[model samples]
Target: MVFQNISTNTKLYVRKGNINIEVKKKATGDRIRRSLGLEDTLSNQALALSIQNLIEKDLSINAFDASLDKYIDKCIKVTETPDDLINLTSLWHKYIEFKRKYWSPTTYANSGLVFAKRFSKLKNQDLRFPQKIQQELFENFSLDAVKRSCIQIKAAINWGLQERIISNVKWTIPNKAFEQLLKRQKEENDINPFSNQERDRIIEAFKTDCFAREKGRHSQYYFAIHFWFLTGCRTGELLGLQWQDIKAGYLTFCRVRSQTNVGEVTKNSLKQQHSRKFPINQQLSNLLVSIPKSKDYVFVNKVGKPISFSSLITCWKRVLSCLQIEYKRPYQCRHTFITDCLKTGKLSPSEVAKLVGTSPAMIYKHYLGAPENIDVPEL
Candidate 1:
């Protein structure tokens, strides 16, 4: 594969190859080529940063080279300076594009979902500011304004820094802000794993639905939830599971994919490397072997696509209602796994982290919050 100094040419004969962007802007040679080093989020960021760097170099008054200048000018067309720099939406869209280009398909979708929920509010709401984008505007916006949105917002801001859209001069958040938000969120929700009795109740309730769907669809959902509890895998990982991924005592998933409704239907997207193997314990392995490999989805709807989150919601609500048990959340499976692991010492903190695809610090912080009342036996 080869790359040519094609800013001078109207058409680029694109092929399935990589580009190497590390070399200093070379003299307008006959050809220019580079390689894309990796395919994950960090790698994508690297590629975008490299391109952003080249553009910034050209932005400098003294920076000049005919071929590179022409290339940079063309990039400027798609990557435009916003008429309203202070507007967060403009900055977010640019960063979203960058994120889409660099992040894994799953990460891109997850980030977009988070961004849409967290930052889209107050859209087009005017925050009067300098006609020119001020780095200070971002530096000083009340952290409260972006608390829930901060994680992804910071990602976009950091991208802006790389692209030279926002200088790092006064653009920084309080170092402790993110940590606090996370700590608080952990305390409030996402950690209440269901108790053993409650777990059994849900299981029994679902299994009792003999006529559900007049077929096996409801049973499949029940089985999928069981798999989620047993494996401590994310909902997506469970939904995206393919029978082909089973081998020996291991079940594999690349990044698990999920669907979304953003006015249009989204499809299964593996957010993490779904190829990683999980211990297909004797029971899970045997159960998997018995189930017919009828569809590509490990868990599908009646129509045979991946199960919608709403499916679980409806099933869970009815089951909880029938059992007369208080409802927590469908994600309690994850929380339950964490608590169970901690109490039983099935795996050490670090080991649990890898198995669950999160950090030890996160596991401890998000889980292990004591219940309001301690269980004590009478003396």
Candidate 2:
């Protein structure tokens, strides 16, 4: 499916089951709509409706003094702004470009991965961020997108607002949309880690089954799963480990690659940047003893190449298919570990937070579930 509009700068297309959107400032290819997230979901008459609505709304709005091109240019130049669309888009581009320059190869891949599959259904969505009753409308959109795995949609939308593609006033359609999205995305991205039974099944599957056809040996899969399961490390972190990083009875994930893999490997500063340390649990410790690690990476592809996070996911998906288990992701292991710990006994939220490399407050808000009801003896 391909969407082309002579009147609008945005063009959407599908390639190999993935949506690729290319936005031009005009037909001549001066690009403005760098955010292609809406590419997949905007097709056919839906595309016309989306463009018509935005254009109509922009014409109607009191926020911008000018049209789309003038507004976008002003935003890129960072002049005065009365709307969220210009400001938000400006920040979004800055962060994304920065991430590209600073993040690791693996870190960079997750965004693209999520963009492709999460919003694959978004070929044609009515993206007219409702003007009145905006708060209510934004919350509903946020809740729906989160469940569908398009949590970043709101953030990207905010960027559009900041850039002045959308209005930018506080409590305006764009701003309220941003607020609701951030709130809901956090709530929705809860860790439903693999259960004990599922964990056991994966471990078993890795040990016994051989997929990928090319690799006859199951040793690598077994070790990778065990390592990921035990540490609750991000798939890439587990795959990214070097022999040198593993010291006497400890694995230090102090230096994680930035999402882009463009800069030198260092601590992650971005929310997406993950730099956490995991203790040497029994499972990992015992497994480490048996495996003869020769290369820099603890986990490698069958070719003995270091596994990037995306590559690990491809393998993981295959593993899940083989085991016939409901597939989440390797990150779910970390979620499982966190939730599992909370269930066992009372550990200070701060203590658990430190181990997981997040705030204690975050633990309770997202993961602690409901508070316990204490029983009192009748007097």
Candidate 3:
């Protein structure tokens, strides 16, 4: 059976055992058809008729949506939703499928992959009960890991609720519990930049292959290490650099290369800003001129491919270990540069923040703290 609203240019019918609606705009002469997600049943016919009436009323006022987005969720059956048996691992995968498009490669690498791995541990635990999740997390993981898992699980479950995926599950990890856990973890927000002497030692170690002489691998990233100290750009932004990004008077710091499951992919743009130009001084110009043009990338590994963050960190740790310098991760090169710029009193916090592609607020918050050693002035 078919129901037609001739005056409104609308038709309601069943095709392939599913109810559908077709609307034609009289002014534009465009036809729009959509599946209503309802099985063919006598009771569903009445509901479809009511929806037709609503669409006709909306059309009369020129308020009908041509895309049919407003009606898409009306047919979601609450009784068909996932129940208490749904596990965190399966639900997390579904949530990722819904959200993966909007995330950057860096976000996926840093947060998404870590959350997915942690959530995989709860494959047998039901997602609907907070007690089970809390127990599993605490029993299997460390305190820090449990806290992180709770935060991420809450976020995922909230997203699932908003999307109508798990309608039966209302219980979530409590906020009071999270606050209690947070209180137990001591916060460490102080900046740990390398000293000038240590920085020079690490750079020389990489340049001369002081650590990996037999493998001859550390020397290939010598230019990369030097560039990080000089410019203070993030690892992804530095790795994304191509020969073309170098201008005559300035270098363009744009784009980011982050590693994902498939391979290395470029993320959108630099954080907080689209792109910025770094003025090329004589020192930077000399460094650029010295590097041989082996590939399109200004930096490459021994095999002449773009440098991956993992590979860079592997070389970084080896160099720092060989030099007997305290290990601060590769990002300290950026911190070291920013701290040195501020300590010189040559640039204000705003200037240092601009040079490092960050905000002055961050500089004041994290970088403005007193150094580890400050000698008292003679009065």
Model 1 over residues 1-379: C-alpha lDDT tens digits? 1222223222122234433343333433333444433233322332333343454455465464444545434332323545334345446656766566666545554465345423333323222432122233345455444453545555666677777876532334554755675555544564677898888767666666743545553565777777777778877677667777777878776645555422213234444433566777787776676565665666666566667776678777766776778777777887787778777866787788777777788876566555654366799
Error of 3 at 308 (Å): 3.3
- Cα lDDT tens digits, model 3, 279-360, are 8889889889988786578998878887777877888887888788878878888889999998998899999898889999
lDDT of 1 at 339: 75
| Candidate that would win on lDDT | 3
lDDT of each: 0.55, 0.53, 0.74
Candidate rank order under lDDT = 3, 1, 2
lDDT of 2 by residue, 286-371 (tens): 88878766667676656776545565567678888887878786778878877777777767777777776778888877777754
Better of 2 and 3 by TM-score: 3
Off by over 4 Å in 1: 1-86, 110-145, 148-188, 210-217, 262-274, 364-379
Q: Cα deviation in Å at residue 245, candidate 3?
A: 1.1
Flag regions of model 2 displaced more than 4 Å.
1-171, 177-190, 210-219, 258-277, 371-379
For candidate 1, give the lDDT of residue 287. 63
